[model samples]
Target: MTILVTGATGTVGRHVVRHLLDHGRRVRALTRHPARAALPAGVEVAEGDLTSAAGLEAAFDGVTAAHLITFGGDYRPLDNGPRIVELAERAGVRRVTVLGGWREGTLEPALRASRLEWTFLQPVQFMANALTDWAGPLRATGRVREPYGDRKSPPIDEHDIGAVAATVLTRDGHAGRSYHLTGPEVLTARAMVAILAEATGRDLRFDELTPDQVRREWVAEGRRPDLSLFRAFSEVDGAGQADLVEMLLRLYGTPNELATTVTGDVERVTGRPPRTFAQWAADHAHHFQP
Candidate 1:
């Protein structure tokens, strides 16, 4: 079976491609830039944009199952969901797995209204956020500054997210289901930093900032927020920087059941326990190295 993977070069999408290859399935990767995608050999790389499905006919042709992402460029939610779903239906694709974020996009509704079998993979947070948000601070100053140091959540590894997606796409009984994926254990920002310190052998410190302090820091950084807040507010129009920062602070500071919930769905689907933060940190320690 040839499986088409959109967002093929993204954090979770890359892992989906690799695990699908490991499953001995023929993989077709969709990317806006095939040259830059650099996916594994033997996989068909198709160049197309998810935002505009005008020229995507060839990409969807002859694909049995596919993986999709809700957001397009700059982390914005895709507004052209109906057209994409129509294209998939026309191509006779049977199954679809969508890697979605906190908020549902236009694609979810379109997928629900379609005849295709669909599953949603909702991860609470990604462990890679350490690399995205804290790596520079850890490398430069040996300190990671953020709010809600004690707010706990079980962040999933992107690799596991990919594995689950592949399993759902390739296997049956996952249709019309949504899985909340997470790591094996709960951890706070400070706890994650401690694990990173042990893994990278660096003198790392987690500095807890007040809500106002966090807002000021984001504004001082020219309001280019990190992945955590950026993805949350990507769909909000004309939202001021302070509004974005406050919303993030509220999200992190509050007690969220979804964020703190750990599920066995990863092991249930992949037949293996999810990787721990320490394991993830150890595997990616070089990214934290000076």
Candidate 2:
């Protein structure tokens, strides 16, 4: 089966491609700049756009399924996801998996309304996102300054997200399912700092800042991120994103014969356990070092 993976070079999409290729499936990776797409050797790289459907004619050709990322350009997944899925259906494709959010327009509604079998992957938060808080400063001073020191969350590993996507794309019985995926443990920023410190054998500090201080710092750094997004980072109702984190812990202990947790889902689908935050840090130590 030829699977076309959009956002083929991103954190999640690269894993999707790698997982598919590891399973011996034919893969076609889509990117705007084909020259820059550093895909695996056997996979085909096609130049395409998810915004206007201008360069996607050949992308869907002979593709039996597709992994769709909601962004391409202008963040118009509402306009483009259906068009691409329509093209896939026209080419007799059977499955479509979407990496949810990260797009301006809603692609879920369009996917649900289509005839194609589909799965939505909504991870609560990526552990890799934590790297943004620490990696830059770690390279400079081995310390991270951020707001809400006690905030905790169940962060999903990006590789696990990819494994689940590969399962939904390649196998059967996953259609019409929306998976709220997350990690096995709920960890605080301080707790994770300790983990990284342990892994790298360096003293890493999590300096707690007030929300106002964080926003001012970001503004000073020339990154005016949306206030709501920043607020979500600091919002701690006892456990910081606790509602979703609790749901994840509830799902984690369930039988593997039933619904999936972050780790079990990746293991069940990929035949490998999900990488932990420490493992991720160890693997990416170069990115954290001076």
Candidate 3:
């Protein structure tokens, strides 16, 4: 079966493509820059924009299932989501796996309304997001500073997210399911800083800052960002950040205060255990240090 994968170059999507290729499935990867796509041999690369369905016809042709990332481009899911689903349905695509973020958005609801077999993969926060956590400051000054040094989350590995997506895309029984993919541990920012310090053998400090301070730093980085998303970090409503620690602990299989879950779910699906945070840090330590 030919599977169409959008966001084929993204952190999670890239792993999906590689795993699909490894499984001997026909993959038609969708990207705006086909030439730049370093897809595996035998995978077909289709140049298209998810924002405009006009270029997607050839990509969806003869595809049986698909994987999609919500932020196609320009973040206009209202305009592009339904069209993409409509085209997939018309092309006789039976199953779709949507990789989603935690925030409320148009794409999630739209996919819920579609007639196709759809599975939503909602990861709390990516382990990769922690790149922003320590990479820059470590490079500049060997310090990772942010607010909520004690606030913990079940930050997942992107490859695990891809493994879940591949399972949903390639198999049955996953339709209408929304998997809250997360790491096997709830790690605080301070704890993570220590992990990095041990991994890199460098003295790393986790500096806590106020919400306003984070906003100012982010603004100074480049263009202005949506403050609500950043503010959501500090605004620990019961349903949001406050619940994250509990949710992650539940997903990761940790109890008490220190025992972390080390499940084989990733290996079960993709023939590998999910990479640990320390392993991730070690591999990416250069990115964190310099």
Off by over 4 Å in 3: 74-78, 102-104, 211-273
Cα deviation in Å at residue 57, candidate 3? 1.4
The true-versus-predicted C-alpha distance at residue 233 of model 2, in Å, is 12
Give the whole-model CA lDDT for all candidates, comma-separated. Answer: 0.89, 0.72, 0.71
Per residue, candidate 1 scores C-alpha lDDT tens digits across 76-145 of 7888999999999999999999999656779999999999999999998899888888888788888877
Residue 169, candidate 3: alpha-carbon lDDT: 86
Model 3 pairs in collision? 184-252, 267-272
Give the candidate number with the greatest lDDT. Answer: 1
**Model 1 alpha-carbon drift over 4 Å, by segment:** 220-227
Whole-structure CA lDDT of model 3 = 0.71
Model 2 scores what on Cα lDDT?
Answer: 0.72
Question: Candidate 2, residues 1-290: lDDT per residue as tens digits?
Answer: 79999888987889999999987899999998899888889989998877767777788889889998775443333455567767777888789998876433446777788889988887766877766556777768877665666666667789889889988888898899877677777677688888888877887787776655644555445443333233332333344343433333343323332222333555655566667787777887667767
Q: Considering TM-score, which of the candidate structures 2 and 3 is the better prediction for this target? A: 2
